[model samples]
Target: MEILQSAAALQAQTEKWRREGQRIGLVPTMGALHDGHLRLVQAAAAENDVVVVSIFVNPTQFNNPDDFRLYPRLPEADAALLGPAGCTALFLPSVEEMYPEQSKLRFDFGSLEQVMEGAHRPGHFNGVATVVSKLFHLSRPHRAYFGQKDLQQVAIIRQLVADLSFDLELITFPTVREADGLAMSSRNRRLSVEARKKAPQLYKALQLGVRLLEENRPVASVKNEVLQFLAMEEAITLEYFEIADARTLQTVEELTQPQEVALCIAAWLAEVRLIDNLLISAKSL
Candidate 1:
């Protein structure tokens, strides 16, 4: 696979591909490749003639500077994994190349940015939108792929596409998970052995919440039960456990109507924060 680090080189290459009538697919990521990330690349490859995966640990997206500094980086390993997974190009740009000048613009998604991740991590989605918008422009792909692991992020990007009129199809695959059910993430690498063992509890808690909701239980009761369950796990510090409309991500108090609902949770597994969610349809319940 071609490893590109400069904007000019990437744009030129993509332009050449465009001139040659090749369908392009873009998968934006922050390095530290795992099966989940590769799944996105494979999905992109299946439908497009060329798949471009961009790996730049976007500094703006991190609410905690320590989180930004501690985020994993494994370019060589990531490239090795991507090349065999059908990636055609890797846009591994440095922070300076990506943000040649300080950004003065900020994005506000109204109600969408007022809950869950947005509420917990202030200005997080703005940074996400900024970098994702940059990737969408730079790659100029016919389609872009993302994992459902980042449920809220997927929702935000969907809105970003509609609001900004970006000409690309957004495809999201199911969240990939480990054998024990922890959602696969780059941050998973930082988990200590004990912490990793307890990490699956997040997924377990989501499962429990889903069961209760599916049984027609009250939203408030389900949340309380889930919270109590997590509290029993001494290593896990719960941040937020929300049941919300899957599309708008607005917190819901009841599942009285047939609609898609997301059971999203964020918690600290020791020092590393982990997030997971389950999407269920009230109709099915």
Candidate 2:
């Protein structure tokens, strides 16, 4: 696989690929490659003739600079992980290359980005949209792959494609998990052994909430039950637990018709903040 560090090189190489008529696929990542990220690349490999994985820790996407600085960068290890996925090229651009001048323009994604992660992280998704929009334009892939772990992000990107009319396809995979059910994440490394053990409760609570919803219980009642479970655990401090409209992400209010919905949560398990979610039809009850 080829490793490209410069934008000019990426453009020139992609131009060559375009001339050769090979379809391109782009996988954007924050560069701590794990099973989940590779899963995305694996999907990209299957769909397109050539897969391009862009490994840039977009500083714009992080509201916490310390967290951004603490993020792991194992480029050599990451490259090895991509080998099995058949990643043909890597677009490894520097931050300056991504943001030459300080970005003055920002995208307002309306209500779609205002709740869930957006509310918690503040200007986080604006940073996400800016860099993603840039990557979409730079790589100009026929299709881009993102993981379903970031459900709110998926909504924003889908809207971005429709509103901007970017000539591309967006593919998503289910949130991956550990054998014991903790969702896979690069930050999983930072968890102490004890926190790691308690981490799976996030998913367990989500599943329990789903069961309660299916029984036609009130949403607030179900949410409280799940909160009680987490509170009993002591180690888990709930940040936000939301059961909302899957599309607009507004509160379900009364679980209106039989539409699909998401139950999303963010919390601190000890010192490590973990996020996870589950999706089910509102009428599944």
Most TM-score-accurate candidate: 1
> TM-score of each candidate?
0.99, 0.97
Q: What's the residue-level lDDT of 157 in candidate 1?
A: 95
Instruction: Give the TM-score (vs. native) of candidate 2.
Output: 0.97
lDDT of 2 by residue, 1-285 (tens): 999988788878777888899899999998888899998998899989899999999988898887788788888889988878889998888998888899998889988877878988988989999989988877788999998888899999999999999999999899999999999998898899999988999999999999998888898899899989889888889999989887788877568666888899899976677888899986656
* Location of the lowest summed lDDT over 10 successive residues in candidate 2: 249-258
The pairs that clash in candidate 1 are: none
Residue lDDT tens for model 1, 144-253? 99999898899899999999999999999999999999999999999999999999999999999999987889999999999999999999999999999999999998
Q: Global lDDT for candidate 2?
A: 0.88
- TM-score of predicted structure 1: 0.99
**Model 2 residue 228 distance off true place after TM-score fit, in angstroms:** 1.1
